[model samples]
Target: MFRVVTPKNDQEFEKYFAFRWQYLRQPWNFPPGSEKDEYEQVAEHRMIVNSEGEVVACGRVHMNTAEEAQIRHIAVHSAYHRRGLGQMMLGALEAVARDQGAIRAVTNSREISIPFFSSCGFVIEREAPTELGLLKRQQMVKKLTDLSSLVLHPKWCTELQKTWSETIPITEHMGIKLHQYTGKTLETRASLNKNINVHGTMFAGSIFSLATLTGWGMIFLQLKEKQLEGDIVLGDGDIHYHKPITMRPRAKCNIESLSGKFSILESNKKCKITLQVNILDDDTPVAEFKGVYWILPGKEASDAKRT
Candidate 1:
């Protein structure tokens, strides 16, 4: 397995800088110090180390706006290329940007690396000047959280939003909105001002609520994708607060882990699954939610029996 983290000591950072130079600059005949740029000090950086404690990959991201961040200097050691280390480092950097309240990520990718970047969900926005002796670059961007493309149907999206607003009146008050339902993951956002407490930060209760609903929505979307109908409910759950959320908080739940639980439903007509939801602020995990959810085939189906 690979471990990713920000370099905390001089030795680790030296290795990180060396790895970048080896992969990105040295091959192009650039000097040693050319791997870094003006953003190093202010940017969020991530280093991935192998089991031997050698830094294998590195990348950096810095805020361009409250809702946007730019990624730069992504490099992976030649020895580890094509092994997915670069994508892992990119994901870590994107997570950092998302926790920082950025809803989008931008990067200028070298032409040789375009396919790799595309595999990680970045799309070319425009082509720009070739730099450092004909290294072609393309301006690319990835939406951190947006529903327009993910939502399968406009009417369904509208109805889901309406249902949440009416059934859970507090959702409307807190300005909670469904951001996307990509079948694999479900995401929602809540306005900071509406959910803020006397401390002028997101309330713990609001965070829990958002996480709970996001998890439930994941199952709901999965049912729709399979052309199946189900009533989803949270049976038991817990939330952990790790950091304070200062901006509009986003909650996301990945349903892949529950694939086995869904298979059980096909055989038994109902299944209970456990899912985890995460709340992010600025690229850091502020809260975590673990929940047990029950799904039944129809309104008339009995509540799921614990097994």
Candidate 2:
């Protein structure tokens, strides 16, 4: 097994820089010290180490402004490709950025790595300057904030939990419960023991259900925060399972990923919104879910259809 860590002592720092140089600088024929920058003293660094104490991946993040952070020096050992260590390292760097009050993160990624960064919730904003006047790069950005236009209240979370238990009886049986809500982000979790499959991992169907409700809950809170009445339903959804979950399953939905118009609901018209939910195994993204939700006019309209 591999673990993510921060280099503290002199020996660990030596190994960390050497690993960064090997994958990031050496391949481009750059000198040894080219792997590091002046921000080393102010930036946050993370690396993944194998059981044998070898560093397989490393990255760094530094605040460029009070609300903006820049990620740099991302490198993963060739032998450790496709193991999700890159995402794990990015997660650690972003966490540090958030703690330091950064609301967004930016990175200059090579053309070959744009797709990998996109899968981690980054979008290309524009073309960045070439590296060493050779490799073309793209400027990518990702939001790190949980704040939205609507203010969140603790009582809203309580009401959402009650609605789930009373309306969807299956949520209780599946062990789904609201884990947290930070106004713009809603986090929920399900018990692995209750939803485990024959393969000894979280059932695919259970993961879908967990992610579905988490997205639904975010929309539900948004409407409640705006004091708008509506009947929300899952119009459609797609989930990509990157890895199995042997531990308890948790899903997080952010308002930053939300797009669409909710104003039409005030005119008694249906509206649609799309959002994403990330299923995590202790800060590592294990699955990604994008969902389209529809909000019908009001509770009366929903009740009329059933009648």
Candidate 3:
């Protein structure tokens, strides 16, 4: 269980501020008070406390414009790395940004942290030069809302959830949840408790299933967008386990490669399209899945039934 909280009082704020300084500033030999700045009073601060009541992660988000916010001082105790606490804090900060009507969240991420930020839906805007020119940093941005308004209806996502829960019993057993689906991306998540292995990491099979279903979900929405009814099935698939997922498992499918496949299906009645899905633990890829899917149009299915 992780708790994201804003320091409710001075005592909590001290712990939160101290954690940030210890992990981020002290290691760099920055002065004691360097961890804080003038923005402390205006920025929204958040931290994650372990069940033991120790602050393990901290970050801040400040609105830079009516539609944009900047995230800074994202730090997690080294002992808490890879546990998804940083990602949890990011989500909390992004939630604050959204509530403030900000459409975009920007941050200057350390080079080592780029993958984590990317996994959280941030894209690299540019690389910035540091003071010493020895270390690399990046300007990253994450879209807080569907600015293009390409989100599908809630009914479709709800129905898709029902279809998986009922038709795929293991999806229900794994506790899979639909996180989001936009114009070209489909995201899903599974609880670690339901899918954990003896090694205390997420089971590989669960990761593959999440990836496969995310790709299928993308095709499902694609069919709806084209106003075509089809039966989508996995024709074949290959998965590479990059690392053991120790946190909540999430999968994403981006559809840039999905373009023009519809033309093949329109001409052939059935088409096999390949999609790549990534399983990430807070933007770190734990597994990669490439699945070839077969989409059979309604007319093609009826014709086969008559044969």
Candidate 4:
């Protein structure tokens, strides 16, 4: 297995920079230190290492503004091509940008690498200056705060968002929106300004509500994907607040944290599933919510049962 990590010591950094220089600069006849820049001291750097401790990929990200980040020096060894090391390194770098409160990320991609960056949710915004005044590049941009590009079932996610806004008017007022649903994970976000308390942070009740809706949306998406129908309701729930969220609040629910089966709903009128949702401020989890959801037969299923 390949693990993504930061350079924690001199030896690890040596390997990381060497790999970056070898893959990104050596072929271009660039100087030995041309692989790095002035941002090295402030940027977040990540390297993908194989099980044997060999660095195979490396990348860096640095904040350009409070809401923008620049990604640089993305390089993966030729032997690691098609193995997803590049994507893994990019993801780690993006996470660092998000953790630093960046809402968007930009990268300069060589012509040959444009497709790879596009596949990872970046779009060409404009032409970028040639690298070392020789290699042509394109400027690509992606919204890190809005994960809609990662949605596997965009139609279902949109339907769920519409249903929430129309059925629960409060959600609209809370600025709740479904951000992403990748079949296995659901992410939802709420505006802090819309849900903030007098203490200048997100209200506890709003946090709980965000988590509840996130978990509910996960079950909704799962059932929809499986061609099942249900009336999802929160049966029980508890929240543990670890910190106050001063920024926008986001809730994430993963399938791995869910327990129970949806197939049971086909045989019986009801099924129960427990799931966990984490509320995050930036990249730090500020609160955790555990909820038990009861899925009862939907109108069509109930009509069939009655018949």
Comparing 3 and 4 by TM-score, which wins?
Answer: 4
Point to the candidate with the largest TM-score: 1
Ranking by lDDT: 4, 2, 3, 1
Clashes of each: 9, 0, 1, 0
lDDT of 2 by residue, 1-307 (tens): 4555688889999999999999888888999998877899998888877768889999999999999999988889998797667766776687678768988999999988899888777899999998878889999998876432112365788788899999988799889988656554677889888998888998899999999999999999988877887888899999999999987588877666789889989888888999999897655569889999988887656775798
Each prediction's RMSD over C-alphas, in Å, is 5.9, 11.9, 12.3, 6.7
List, residue by residue over 6-25, the lDDT tens digit for candidate 3. 78788988898888889887
Once superposed on the true structure, which residue ranges of model 3 sit more than 4 Å away at CA?
1-151, 302-307
Q: After superposition, how far is residue 228 of candidate 3 from its true place, in Å?
A: 0.9
Residues 32-72 of candidate 1: C-alpha lDDT, one tens digit per residue: 99888777888887887765888888888999899999998
Assess each prediction's global lDDT (C-alpha) against the native. 0.76, 0.83, 0.78, 0.83
Q: Which regions of candidate 2 fall more than 4 Å away from where they truly are? A: 1-152, 303-307
Cα error, candidate 2, residue 305 (Å): 4.8
Q: lDDT of candidate 1?
A: 0.76
Candidate 2: pairs in clash: none
- Each model's TM-score, in the order given? 0.64, 0.53, 0.54, 0.62
